[model samples]
Target: MNNTVVVAIPATTANMGPGFDCLGMSLSLYNEIHMSLTPGFINIEIEGEGAEDIARDERNIVFCAAKRVFTEIGESCVGLSIKLINQIPASRGLGSSASAIVGGLVAANKLTGSRLSQERLLDLATEMEGHPDNVAPALLGGIIVSVFQEGKVHYLRVSPPEGLNAVVAIPEFHLSTHSAREVLPKQVSMKDAVFNLSRSALLVAALCQNRLEMLRVAGTDALHQPYRTKLIPGMNEVIEGALQAGALNVTLSGAGPTVIALTDGEKPAVNDAMKGAFQRAGVSCQVKNLKPTVEGARII
Candidate 1:
């Protein structure tokens, strides 16, 4: 077995409008993990974003994932050293946790003589993640549609069109997925349920056809977003401002505080408008223009 391995996993935005835990796409942003076998104890080092307060010991997600893979492969415990270079922000609807999980597993797989196939690795990852949408796209890239069915996983990839750019506006505050999910109602009205179902299908069709105009209707969600929007103080204003500023569509990114706007151009105007809305709402935010990553997770 190799003594060392390095893996890079891209950050992902899941449930890009109405897909809600079933759709996602990888972005260019990444978190990198390097692992090497040592003699006695587990050691960790972290740098870049989300590093300052993150644990540098076994409690780290990378360590946990690596340990899990090693145990699954029947490998004896060796001292392990892990260095994480994080570029993705934690708990902001970007797949930071998924990156750590995928990175560690990929490194562990490479170190253990590649005993796990891609399917097995993804299965392990989804199990660890508790959901496959973000992890699947982060590992596979492009636009991914996934569903867990009959004790097996099924997925398909579609190419994103050239004219669209993803404009992500990230707020400074953190919104835990747990807290965000807690806001959702236990039961939804049949009309609302049907509304989301129709929009979700429309969203898929719009993306497949690169029909930017259709996104205005397709991105509307009556299920989770309405309940969760109150958690984000200026969510409605941000969405409205971005759309009015020429965004093709706007939606919450993952479990966000991070709002994503889809546009036909670079959409600096839309980004600025969204930022202004955040500022008016007394929240600080940063905006970046990101393109869909064609490749997902990879060892380097």
Candidate 2:
């Protein structure tokens, strides 16, 4: 088998509305990676995102993931050279890290003669990520609803409907996932739990059935967003403006510092309004219009 392995993984948005650590969807953005074996030495190269800040040594998540795969199979690898062509922004609530973990595992699996099945790979990825929301969708693509219980992941993938689009407003600042989760309450009331449950079910049904009206109610979350709002300035205003500008619903993308608005035909207006809201709040951000996808990680 050829030692050279190349893979492409997509960017994703997690915790869409009320799904909160359960729902995630893959976006059009992608990161391409190439890996090869070397002897007694390692070389790391990157083209975009976290080039200077990301670990260049064995501590890197990509390298760790690849190493983990080898360890799991009791195989010995001399060294590794990783080339990453990254497009997803780091710490932007856009699933950049998830893609990296997936890229490494997939490349190592291919180089090792595909010893592990995709299901096993998924479990490994989720374990590395500490949650299945982001990695599950990054591995399988599409709109994913996942439940992680007893070290196993149960998931359903749904294709996004036509004319249903997303506008992502990414702020200039970065909020690490650790910091974002720290702001969350240690425990939530049952009322909030039930609230999120009902909306999560609605969200999955609405996105699959193309019921735009349901999104407004389906996206509101009392479990996390309400508490996390304090971490993001002008959060409510941005959500309100997007809805007024014709977006069906607006919510924080993953943690905070980036906001996403769900739209149908008013993508441009919603984009403008989201940007304008951030601008009015004295925050600088970049906006992008992206379509959800059905593709996942694979070697080409």
User: How do all models score by TM-score?
Assistant: 0.97, 0.97
lDDT of 2: 0.88
Mark the 10 consecutive residues where model 2 has the least summed lDDT.
Answer: 262-271
**lDDT of candidate 2 at residue 207, scale 0 to 100:** 87
Compose the digit string of candidate 1's lDDT tens values, residues 25-82: 8988989988998879888999998888788887899888888888988887587899
lDDT for model 1, please. Answer: 0.88
lDDT by residue for model 2 (36-147), tens: 9997988889888778788888988888999989998998768999999898889989999999998899899999889998888888999999998899888898998888
Please list the residue runs of candidate 2 whose C-alpha ends up more than 4 Å from where it truly belongs after superposition: none
